[model samples]
Target: MVAGGFSELGEEGRMLEAQVKARINGTGTRVIGPNTVGVLFPHSALNTALTPNDRIYYPGKGSVAFISQSGALGLLVMDSITEFGMGVSGFVNIGNRADVTEVEVLSMFMDDPNTRSIVLYLESISDGATFFSKAMEASLTKPVVMLKTGRSEESSRAASFHTGAMATDDRVLDGVLRQAGVICAYDEVELLDYGKVLAYQSPPSGDRIAVITTAGGVGVVTTDLLTTAHDGVRLRMAAFSPEEKAELRKYALPIASVNNPIDLTADGSSEAYA
Candidate 1:
């Protein structure tokens, strides 16, 4: 992997990058990045990360494989994973995508037996159709979580300057992700959280949920969250029909509100909930 920086946006750097690629064109050598920190495999103890090893913390071997378009953010994510007491099977920084691409690496991780979930932070896609195709197939076997940046025009320009990546229309991206059956995380934390949760837990069969709480205010807040749309996806509160409520009332406490957000009250026994 070429862990060195190349200013693809500049003329001289582009020329140099071309020369580097030509040197190894037919040698069967694959390059990861010109602006990337490179790849890391915690299980195999192989690290070609460009970041200083002394200052950065690395995650242990685990089921998640993280792919990032940003080199520095990739390091920060590794540090954050260690802090969160989580580990990754592998971490790859697909910088500039001169040769290797996000979808290609994603396909590689899909074949890896150790990877249960795939998480990616992307600013742009080099090949959108292939990415969606590969992601759709991978999602059928394991979870695929993405945290995509460059939503706004300003950020789109910023990303182009940063990685020389072309941005896609956000509206189109949303529809594509849904068709691909890939989960979208709003931020960095959500990306990791969704990855961890998906790795450890089975996905719910449906969006219907029942919130049970001793505190009415907490239940109300949770209900709002369940009903509210986030990143184009919304949860549905499981409405308790009159018949279901009547049945629950038979066993619940006298003052319990047998509604969707079931308020058992503080006095309600644990047995009543059961």
Candidate 2:
């Protein structure tokens, strides 16, 4: 079995034997990659890696499967998600997707009993039509949240620097992702936040958003944000109810404009969360 990226030759062979020997009495079985972080079936306790192996700190296994194109980035996400208290059923770093493409991994997760959600961080979409078809099918069964990069001109150049991938059109990709019901994260923080939100929070039944802020100025900004048109989607604010307007005045300045962004005039507290 190949360990890492290199196969065992004469000198490397001796080193490999010694390392494997010290770990498991020289009886370590066939491993896929020596330079790879082991895959974990958190529910099954099946760790297929040649590294110091254990799952002492992994969160409770659940229905989410995280599939990443870059193994290193995938590991980073794993560490972050663990700290954030998100649970996972399986993790696959489909390097180059050489043998295992996103479609295959997705299909497997679809049939997997434990997987409930799927998180994807892909730099490239290899086969657009195929990915969309499979993603649509999987999403019908479970939600798929994606943090895709390399869409913009600058980001495309940056992606090539990190991973020799030929960047494609970001606009078309964005359309495809939206049409497929895949949520896109604009930044890394948003990526994790949205991932955690989608993983734990219930999907909004409707797009009606009520913003409660601490100041009139903040409310104004929020109103602008909701009204500002970007891409094809425009935020359509629902008219506030008479009771909702009254609630806004309780915490807002006497002169504060009572609108969609109901500012509490710097008097709101954690209790406002409802």
Candidate 3:
């Protein structure tokens, strides 16, 4: 890792070379910090970091390539996905983004046969127009879920501790992402949850959902959540046929009420989901 950051490397180019070299070298085999966090190509079974860590658990080889600007988050995501029982084909932590970027990663993943989805947690955009254009191109082939941090002045203040600079340009980033069809997550948990959902499910064939609940109050709250205006989400309740409504009565409580947010009342069970 030390060898990767040497001054023989001018500042950017040479340093990147050193990092790549350390990755290529075996005796220097276990090093991962010459310039950036090394990548994981799961199909190859390649683990060459200096510490020889195997923290990422990707199973069955799926098509999502996770790219993050923060190395630590990259590692954490690997662990999270493993816990969630999902598989990943590639992982990249493009620190400094001096050599690789979200645009480049998206471009590469779009072409990779194994990648059907892409997840990103970005801090800032070095080139907004170029990134958005590339992202749009990639999205035509696969879904991209992005969680952009450092949105407010306060968050930017926190960002300075890591990269020593404020990184928020909230409106511009939001506009660019939405125009390109990139789904944004608001926080880490949301990032994982929504990304997982998109990874497994196809985009809505239509924008209608049928909510069946036993609790009326819970159903009301859920309807409010879905109907409340938001930037990227607009959900509509699906209508059921009379026959479907009649079938619902078999499982509804004696006085159950059925509507857009259908209250299955007291008869719903785990088997319903199964």
Candidate 4:
């Protein structure tokens, strides 16, 4: 049940929102949002988004549960889910959060057997302590990745205007989230990418990774990216032994280099990949 013109507009809007919240104070029913597009459980075919069906198609069933504070951004992400090759178990648009907040939705997702990972696009946090505690608990079982915007002073002011949210210090927020075991994403793409990877793959037992590519430059870039520290996880490129290189050369082209990346050159074939 999402209705805009609440809280973000002015005093009248805030009063209206307060009244609405008061009405649901002691009810059996729980509301997700008063100013939101609403929730979507894709696996169950339950979609309450205000966005028209024609504007965004279902991204198919997945194990990632997404919660967003911005309705428009949620819709945009939903529209791109298919392109991103990630699916959704559930999606929540927690706009204004007059009644329900991100903490409640996060608890639901954490207990949901269908959800393997959680992603969030948050403009602000309503309750910092509760959010940190809930996120820490949830991340113990599944990955909780967040894309928190409004880092800049100008952007924070803009966010206040957009959703009536107060901005916290970015550095402190980042440290708090990290300490809570939440993976912070810099942008929407990183959020989706993290979700996609977590959805499709098991967590690596070790930080050592091997890269194999036909293009040398691509392998180099990937190696560079992996070796960098992310959320305190430092990845190291796995080194191939001489014997390992010799065995790989039997399958690779003569010109192929048998380094850590194992570049197979332009003439690399399917057998080389195998």
* lDDT tens readout by residue for model 2, 192-253: 66556666665566766777777777776776766666621245667898998897667556
Over 119-177, each residue of candidate 4 has an lDDT whose tens digit, in order, gives 99998999999999999999988999999999999999888888888898999999999
Whole-model Cα lDDT per candidate?
0.87, 0.66, 0.68, 0.87
The candidate that achieves the highest TM-score relative to the unseen native structure: 1
Clashes of each: 0, 8, 4, 0
For candidate 3, write residues 1-274 as lDDT tens digits.
3233332234564466556665566653333333345677776675432223454444436567888766677777777877878777677766555435567777888888877788897777757789889888887768888988888888776654443333757988887897898877787767777767777776676778877777889988887766665633668878888988887767666677766687665666665423
TM-score of each: 0.90, 0.72, 0.77, 0.88
Q: Is candidate 3 or 4 superior in TM-score?
A: 4
Candidate 1 regions with alpha-carbon error over 4 angstroms:
1-8, 230-232, 246-253, 266-274
Estimate candidate 1's alpha-carbon lDDT, on a 0 to 1 scale: 0.87
Model 2, stretches more than 4 Å misplaced? Answer: 1-38, 49-59, 153-164, 217-235, 243-258, 269-274
- Give the CA lDDT, 0 to 100, for residue 98 in model 4: 86
